[model samples]
Target: MPEALAILQKYWQHDTFRSLQKEIIDSVLSGHDTFALMPTGGGKSICFQVPALMNEGICLVVSPLVALMKDQVANLQNRGIKGIALTGGIKQDEIIDLLDNCQYGNYKFLYVSPERLQSDWILDRIKNLSINLITIDEAHCVSQWGHDFRPAYLKISELKKHFPKIPFLALTATATPRVKEDIITELGMHNPVQFEKSFARKNIAYMVFEVEDKLFKIEQILKKNPQPSIIYVRNRKSCLEISSQLQTLGFKATFYHGGLTSREKDKNMQLWMEEKAQVIVATNAFGMGIDKPNVKTVIHIQLPENIENYYQEAGRSGRNGEKAFAVLLTSPSDSIQAESQFINVLPDKAFLMSMYNKLCNYLQIAYGEGINEEFTFNLNHFCHKYGFPTLKTYNAIQFLDGQGIITFLKEFSEKITLQFLIPSKEVIRYTSLNPNDEEIILTILRTYPGIYEIQAAFNLPLIAKKSHHSEAEILAVLHKLNEKGIIDYHSKNNDAVLIFNEIREDERTINKVSKHLIRQNELKKEQLQSVLNYVAEKNTCKSKMILNYFGEKATTNCGICSYCITQAKPKKDFSTLSNKIMALLQNEDLSSREIQNKTKNTADDVIFVLQQLLEDNFLIIQNNNKYTLKT
Candidate 1:
């Protein structure tokens, strides 16, 4: 147990664990099933990672997001630790090889998507491995009570049957008490030790402004802060539209969404990360695994469907312990839009069954024939071909996903592979003959080994930067190499993958999960109503309200929140202050603070009066600070 701290300091370069992180790790090390409810950025990974490094056997991490697992595995690899991830997009041979490496190659961690656990072959191989810890990331997804429940997560408990002795750790950024109990029960966790950190992010000042002009409010926020920020919108179109508007306002901005290609996503993220762009306009897809610590503001252009989602998204700010703002900009129609987006559009049981049938027909899968099969799904194409509304159809698929009839695996960025056809000696000779292509050829030869024999994953943007060329130029060179028989290139960029969990089920089978769908939709509407109530709430302290929702008792008001600051205090009346201000400013100009001293009134009252005076043409603001008679 003493060596655990050494391992953490050695690998993570940290002096000590965050609050409760060490305790959670110690509980797991002592072989207890653990459920950790750490807020986002609360060092949840360390709870499992440190213990994995200290223990003898490999730690199996089951996560829902492929990109997140890939990023973590790559980070581990960079730290000289061996790790592999198995997701839908991985090739079969690659999976075999990766599993083999985990079994014999001293791999400390193996990350797998929950859907991949359905494979009997994978289970068979996993049973043979000496597993020590089973960690489930986003464990909330397993519970029907959770906001993002996925039915495939239920299969995680199956691993317990195979390895009865292995300890399990389930973690999520946000989970209500009901969801917590469900995770514990569904995972078959026996008296698991639970650890929860306070969900309050004191550094983030939660704000909600019901504004008529969202863009104008956004502009004001950006201009006031002007630090690295993220602006979250509802859809891809808004991502682009808002980003362009910000650019038009003379701010350096970029947009990201699930619709963009992997290369484009990476390029745009890099631009923001490197400070080339001051703001990133994006959908909710943009925040996971993004570690930009200096973000000063996170503004939501629309309300999220639930408080859990909103809290997690807003928590992305102020990671470096600096004061930051999380502001939600709401229009009159935002509540209506949110209801339509999340609640009203949720397909009923009939729609779910019909969509399921249509999906089976669309994929040409006969009843009892498509179990455990994976397909390249184009939702837009499917909707257009069948005359289904895209949003409703997608939501129905999501409903189906939660019911375990199908697994909706989102898009994962694929790796590009290149294999050389020309011999090594011939490559040098060709480069000498073709000086223009010399840098790229030399770079490929230097960076990727055995390219002449087998395809190796290559990063196009990385290679371009190394060779001091553009990605387009490097791609052109690769294409030229292919044409000249110098190399064979395979770029593996593709859309989301859908896997059928059961054979095409009839109405009876689909109806079993229909109740779950109805319950889920009902819970979603309840959550939406809660958010609307929070937005419309004017008396409660903002921080206290949010903290209470997460089951924390917040006794003291967060005095800095917008609500606390705006709450009327006992003081001189506003009209009196307004008249005093006008009399004070009749002859000489004065700044706000000067006026405040002269009037001996509360600062809020003075400021309120000043604003009314300016609005009513009783005074004029000049030089950005002084106020005088309007005359």
Candidate 2:
């Protein structure tokens, strides 16, 4: 066996590489600048990881997300491979120690965020390491045309000067042709070997439905599938509400969103992964490093912000090669809502400049000063003080962060402490009276060994998992316990930390990236338009549409998509069908099903003709909820 194959088997325990994996690995191993455009679940990691292992020194991986870096590092550690992640919040001394370890401790992988590359000291340290390969994950971020463009990703090209001979491997799950060209050019790849696997999931049946009641449609889909599924919503509120609605309707469901505590997110994710929950309703934040091969359906309850996001989220299903569904549920109002949610909120160059000036003032940073200064930022307080709209202000700040003018660290700490005020006997009596809260209280008592003696910090989500409850339920019980003097519970949420990367040259800073800002807004508009078109276009195959968007010219339509399924049915003479329905309705009122039975036409065709008749004022629905001829 090849050395790369041996390494893959030893580490990943896979007997063979997925399509394009081996070839990409070979290209990288042969010291070529390689670009691998594999779709999600295509094992893009292995293309770099396996070959990196076969080399003599460590691999340096530059990624866009700190969470992704941490996940990859954890996975490497789990396989007995030494890896280190230089994520945010690490002090310079700790970074020195970690770099030292990477230099001498036989570390095989060093994962760092693209922002970390901007530090000269860190780059100097990295220069001394025995790096064999340079891998850029989410490489599309380097391109302004990409959906998730980050200016910090451009700094990755500077590493080429340091390791001029090392092979550079760029990997991304989704990138348009424009973004693809930008990635290669920005990375300064020399005669790069590009491998693009078709962005088509043959096993997934893309489905779209326009419905009056989304929840009812969701229920019907879940009932018919009865398998592990994901329902994607746009916000945390929807995540909670939809998941709760599903649970009330007798489905095992859980909710996840960015607002969730890390422990809560873990517990909820565990429930879904373990199959204890049949459905997980979440926002776009849920599926970064998750790979569950058995997700039978991915239903989007709202229009996604763009096609790239929707493609990645929807592609999460059908990974096990069985037939799965990617369903989008929309309403007449969703298009307007989507426009308001995505387009209207886009911060233009003017808004970005104004917000940047305001941010400088809010932070009290003087001109040409406050570089490298970090402050605790309360977004709501800042927005209220300036009388700026919250969402747009947030987007402006995010744009600033993306442009590398600032570093916004949104992950803050939540401190929760607990101590039992009542004696053990009293607690037992209280639990006996409130049996519903018994499991939670008992789990807390068992998990925190010193809760009775002193105030202890407990994992809220762990208790919820052990008690088979949710974090909200656990918090409610804790608050109740505190109210009754059974326990002393205190929870404190901290504000986010913002680090100013550049000095306060407010207008100049915005001006330097003005073109990028304008281009980014345009790109967002185009992407959102693509999504709207995808949802609105009913004549084309959904799979072919997605494939075409990703720059692949699909020659054949996928027969399993909603459009293909509808088109495959024999075309009905709708006028003839309508006449028959009208004649039947002339005699007596009949329900749609009864009409189908009498006419011997498919329910869908019958419903279509009935709708046409009703729209033309040739029919009406009586109080008995049956079709009837107008008197």
TM-score of each: 0.80, 0.85
Tens-place lDDT per residue, model 1, 42-91, is 98888999999888889999998877998999899899999988876466
Residue 606 of model 1 has an lDDT of 71
For model 2, the local distance difference test gives: 0.89
Per-residue error for 230 in candidate 2, Å, reads 0.6
Q: Per-model C-alpha lDDT, please?
A: 0.86, 0.89
Candidate 2: residue 159 Cα off by (Å): 1.6
For candidate 2, the 10 contiguous residues with the lowest summed lDDT are 602-611
Q: Which candidate achieves the best lDDT against the true structure?
A: 2
Candidate maximizing TM-score: 2
Stretches > 4 Å off in candidate 2: 416-491, 573-607, 610-631
Residues 592-614 of candidate 2 have per-residue lDDT tens digits of: 77887899986557767877888
Residue 574, model 2: Cα distance from true site in angstroms: 4.9
